[model samples]
Target chain A: MTSLLALGILLLTAFLLLVVALLTRNSTPRFREIPALTRLVRTLGLSVEDGKRLHISLGHGSLLDERGGSAFAGLAALRIITEKTSVSDMPSVASAGDPALGLLTQDTMQAGYQAAGVEELYVPTTSRVTGLTPFSYAAGAMHIASNENVSTNIMIGHFGPEAGLLADISDRDYVTLIGASDNLAGQSVLYASTQDALIGEELFATGAYLGAGTSHSASLTVQDILRWLIIITLLGGAAAKFVGVI
Target chain B: MRVLTAVIAIAVGLMVLLGYFFAEFVGIQTLLLNWAVILAGVASLVGIFNLIAVHTDKVRRAEKGGVYSALLVIALVATFVFGLILQPQHQIMQVLLNGIILPVEATLMGLLTITLLYAAIRLLRRRADVMSVFFIITAVLIFLGSATLPTGDVPVIGTLIRPWVSQIWALGGARGILIGVALGTLVTGLRVLFGIDRPYGGK
Candidate 1:
C-alpha cells in the first residue's frame, strides 16, 4: 500500500510536469547536449548518405519484467531510426532476442514507415528475432552487424556481459558502435568496449535526443526532477543516520 | 484504427497497473496477461518461421554465407524433429542440451573473459582520460583484492581499500543508477499510458 501510494505520487507529479512542459512549448527548449546522442544522430545521417545499413541490436529483454524498460526505450529508438532512414537505399534493420520485443520492433518499424508515408517499403523481416538465448542473441546480432554492410551499430536494451562479443565483432569490423544497457555488467562491458556508451538514464533519453517528440523531452524533465528528489532523500537519510536521529 | 488500438492498449495497461493497488482488477489483469502470454508464444512461432524464411532466402540467393544458412536450416529441422518425437525429458534431448547447448553456451561465456580483457587493453590505449584511468584502477583493485595470493591476502589494498571501494563507493553509485533507471521506467510507462508514445502500432 505504501509503495502503491508512492508510485501514485510519482505518476501524478510526472503527469503534471508533462502537462506543464507541453503547455509551455512556444519556444525551443534548450538541453545540455549528450555527445553520444549527438554522434548517433550524425551517424544516422551519414549511414543513410553513404548507403550503408544501420543495425540496431535490441538486447534480450521481455516486456513482462522490469528489464522491459530499456527494451521499450530501444523500441522507441528504433522507431526514430526507422523513420529517419526509411528513404535510404539500405533500410536499417533491428534484431531482438525476445519474440515479443521482435514483434514490437516490427510494429514500431511499420508504424515508422507509415508515418513516413512509405509503408509499402516496410519489410516485416527487417526486425527479427535473431535468437532466443543471450549468447545466441549476441552471436546472431554480431553476424548482422559484421555481415550486413552495417557501418553503424546501435545497441540499447537489457544486455548482459555477453554483449562483449558483439562489441568485439563490431570493433573488428571497424563499425561505429554506440551501446547502452540497464544491466550493470552490460554497462561496464559496453563502456570499456565502445567509444560512445550511454550509462543508466542516458539510455532512456534516446527518444528525446533523437527528436521522437516534445513529450520525450518533457519526460526527461520529469526524470531529472525525480532523480534530484531521490538524491536529496538519500542524503537526508544518510545525515539522519549519521546523527542517530532514526 | 490507431485510436482504437490506443484505447485498447491504455485500457489494458491501466487494468494491469491498477491490479497492484486494487484487488478487483486482479482477475482481469490475470486474464489479460494470460492472453498476452499466448500471444507471445504465437509470436515466437512466427519468429521461428521468419528465421527459417530468412535463411531459406539466403540459400536460394546463393548469398556469401548460404552454406552456413543451409547447415542452420538442417540443424534446426533435425533438432525440432528429435525434440518433438523424443520429448525434451528423453535421453536424446538431454544429450542435446548437456552435450551441445550447455557446452556451446559455456564456451561463449568463456570467450567473454578474453573479449573483456582485450577491450580493457584497447580502452587504455584509446582513452587514457581521468575517468578511464579511475575505472581501470578500480577494476584492477577489485580483481586483485578478490584474488588470493599463494601465500596470503594482500595488506591494505585487499583488507581496507577494496572493501571501502566496493562496499561503499560502488554500492552508492549502483543505487544512484538504479534510482534513475526506475524514474525513467516510470516516465516511459506513463507516456505510453497517456498515449504520448505508442509503440503498439498506434499513431
Candidate 2:
C-alpha cells in the first residue's frame, strides 16, 4: 500500500487544476473547431427539421473498466444531443452494450429534459440496453440504424473494431456517421468508416466543444494544461538522457 | 437535493481514488464498488425485463414491426428456458454459446473487413485531406507488406520494410493515441470526482 505515488500525485494535480480552472474561468473555454462535431450538431438540427430519429450508441463499455472515461464522455454527448432535441420533440434513441451505461445514458437524457424543461417528453424506452457484448452490441445497434428512420448516428464510447459494421450501416442507409472511440482499433476502423471521426483524446473534448457549460470547458482546459506539462516533461527527460546527465 | 447527490458522489469518488494510496481505506472502497457491481447486475435484469416489456407492447399493439418483436420474444424465451433447464455448463448450452453465438459473432467480424475496404475506398472520395491521403497510403503499404509472396518472403520489401513500417511507424502512432487516451481518461475521471461532471444527473 501507499506505493502508487505517481498515480496519487497525478490525481491530486488534476483535481487541483480542475478546481482552479472552474473558479477562475468567467466564460466557457473556447475549443478549436472540430468539423465533425460541429457538423454533428448541425445534423442534429437537420434531424429535428426533417422530423427523423437520431440514434446514439454508448458502445460496449462498462463503468468498472478503464474505458469508463470514454463512456462518461459519451454520456456528456448524450446530454448535448438530448438538450437540443428536447426542445422540438426530435425523437432520439440511446443504446448501450452495458446496462449500467444504459442506466447512465437514461439519466443523462432525463437531465437533458430537465435542463430543457421538457421532463414530460422523456421516455424510458429512448435509452435502452441493446446488447451485452461488443459484436452483439454492434449488430443490435446496426439493426436500429438500418430499420429505424434514423437521420443521424453518433457513437462516442469504448467501441472495438466491431464499430466498422455500424459505420457500414450508416453508409448503407445514408445516415450521417459521427463517431469517437477510445480503443485504438476502433479509432482506425472509424477513420475508414465514419464521415467524422474524433481521433484519440478528441472524444473526451465532446462536452467542452458542445458548450455544455463552463465546468465542462474547465475540465478540458485542465486536460490541455496537463498535456502541455507532460509534453515538456518528456522533452526535458529526453534532453537530459541524451546529455548523459544521469 | 442536487447538492446532496453531488456530495455523495464526491465522497464516494474520493474514497475510491484514495483507496489506491491508503490500505486502511481499501475495505470500504471495495465494499462500495461491490455494491455498485451488484446494483449493475440488478440493473441488467431490469434492462432485459424492460426490453421484454417494450417488445411485448409492440406485439400487443400490432405495430408495423410487431412480428419481429414477437419473434424476438419467442427466441428470448426459448433461449432462457433452455439455459435454465440445461445450465450453462451443459452440452446444449455449449452448443448454443459456442456453435451459434460464436459463429454469428465471427461472421460479424468478417463483415468488418469488407466494410473497412468500402470505407477506405470512400475515404478519399469524402475527404481529400492530407491525413486521409496519409491514412490510405499507410493502409496500402501495410496491406501489401503483410502479404506473403508465392515465391517466398521478399527480402527488403517483406522482411525489412514491412516490419520497420509496422513496428516503428504504425506502433508509434498507436502508442501516441494510447497515451492521449490515457491522459484523457485521467482528466475525465477527475472531472467526475471533482463534481464538475454529473453523469448520474442529480448535479
Candidate 3:
C-alpha cells in the first residue's frame, strides 16, 4: 500500500509537471548558480581554443544497477559535451568502467558526430573500456590523464575514494578537473580535491542544466516540487510530534 | 528505429517494474533481470574484444605507447589462456586473485590514503575555509581514534571527538546525502520508465 501511494504520487507529480512545462512554453524557469557547470563550459571552450582534447570518465558504474542513476546523468553530460565538441578538431574522449557503458559511450559519441555532420572526425578508439573494477578503472583513467595530454578531466559517475587518485593524477598534469560522484567517500574526496565538484543531487541536474530538452527540465521540476513537499511533511510531522499529536 | 527502441524500452521497463509491486509477474521480472545480467556478461566479453581491436590498431599505427599496448595484449592473452586451461576457480586462479590482484588493489588503496592526505593538505592550502579546517581535524581525529596507542589505550581527545564527528555528524550528513540520492534515483528511474529521457542512443 505504501509503495502504491508513493508510485501514485510520483506519477501524478510527473504528469502535472509535464503539463505545466508544456503550457508554460513562453516562460522559462530560472535556475540558481551552478559553478561546476559554468566552469565546465569555460574549460571546454579553452580546450577547443588550445587544440587540446577533453577527457571524460564515466566511472565504474554498471548501467544495469539501481545506483546507475549517476552514470545515466554522467552519460547525459557526455552527450551534451560530445555534441559541443563534435564540431571541433579536438573531439572529447570518454572512458567507462562497464562494458555496457563503454558501448553506450561509443554510441553517444557517434550520435554526437552524426548530429554535427562530422562523422569522419569521430574516432572509434576515443571511447575506451578502461577497466572493469573500481581501482583498476582509476589506474587506467590516471594513465590516460597523464599520457593523453588531456586539457580538462570531467570525471562523473559512481566513484569511490579512488576518485581522489584520479584528481591527484589530474593535478599532477595540471589539468582542469570537473567531477561528480554518488559515492559518499568519493564525494568527500571530490570536496577535498576538486574545486568544482557536483554534490549529491546536483549530479542529477546535468541534463536539465546543460539544456538537453524539456523532458529533463520537467523531470527536474518534479523533483524540486517533491523535495518541497517532503520538507513540508518533515517539518509538519516534527511540529505535530512536539505537540503530542500523531 | 528510435520509436521501436523506445517502445521496447517502455514495455520491458514497465513490465519488470509492475512485477515488483504485484507478485503475479514475479517470474517475468526475474527472467527479465536475469536476461539483463546475461547480456551484461556478453557485453563484457565484447568489450574485451573491442579493447583488443583498439590495442591492435595502436600497435599497427606504431603509436607512442605501442610497446605497452603489445605488453597488455601479451598479458591479456596469457591470462585468458591460463584461465581457460585451469578453470576459473582453480588454485592458479586463486593465486592470481589473492597474490596478484589483491596486492595490486591493496597498493592502490594505500596510495589512495596518501592521495587523500595530500588532497586534504591541498584543500587547506587552496581554500583555507573553516570547513576545510574542520574536515582535516575530523579526519585526523578519526585516524587517531581508530589507532591503538603505545600505552594500549585510545587517546582521550581522539576518543571524545571520534564518536561525535563520525557516528553523529558524519552519519547525519551521510543520511541526508543518501536521501537526496534516493530521490534522484527515483526521478531518473521514472524518466526512463515513462520515456521522458532515453540514454540508450534512441531519439
Using TM-score, give the best candidate's number: 1
Task: Flag the better candidate by lDDT, 1 or 3.
Answer: 1
Q: In terms of TM-score, which candidate is stronger, 1 or 2?
A: 1
Give lDDT per model, in order. 0.87, 0.84, 0.83
lDDT of 1 by residue, B89-168 (tens): 99989998999888999999999999999999999786778989999999999998888998676788889989999999
The digit string of per-residue lDDT tens for model 3 on A1-246 reads 987996687677667666866865666766788999888877766777788888999998887776588888888788888888887666788988899988888888887777777778889888989788999788878877877778999987899899999999999889989888989989989999988688888888877777777767776777777788878988999999999998
Whole-model lDDT for model 2 versus the true structure? Answer: 0.84
Please give, as one word, the docking class of candidate 2.
medium
* Candidate 3 RMSD to the real structure: 1.9
Docking class of 1: medium
Candidate 1 displacement at residue A205 in angstroms: 0.6
- Residues B1-203, model 2: lDDT tens digits: 88888899899988887787778889999999999899999988877876787678778988767888898889888898998898989998898889989999899888888888988999999888999999998888777777878987776767787789889998988887887898788877877877877888433
- The lDDT of model 1 is 0.87
Mind giving the per-residue lDDT tens digits that candidate 3 earns over B1-203? 88888899899998888886789879999999999999999989978887788778878999778898898788888889999999899998899889988899999999998998889888978778888898888888888888877776476756677788888999988987887787787777777777766677523
Q: Which stretches of candidate 2 lie over 4 Å from their true place?
A: A1-4, B149-151, B201-203
For model 1, residues A111-225, the per-residue Cα lDDT tens digits are: 8898899999987778888889999888889888888899998999999999999999999999999998999999999999988789999999999899887787887887887
- In the order shown, the chain A TM-scores of the predictions are 0.95, 0.93, 0.94
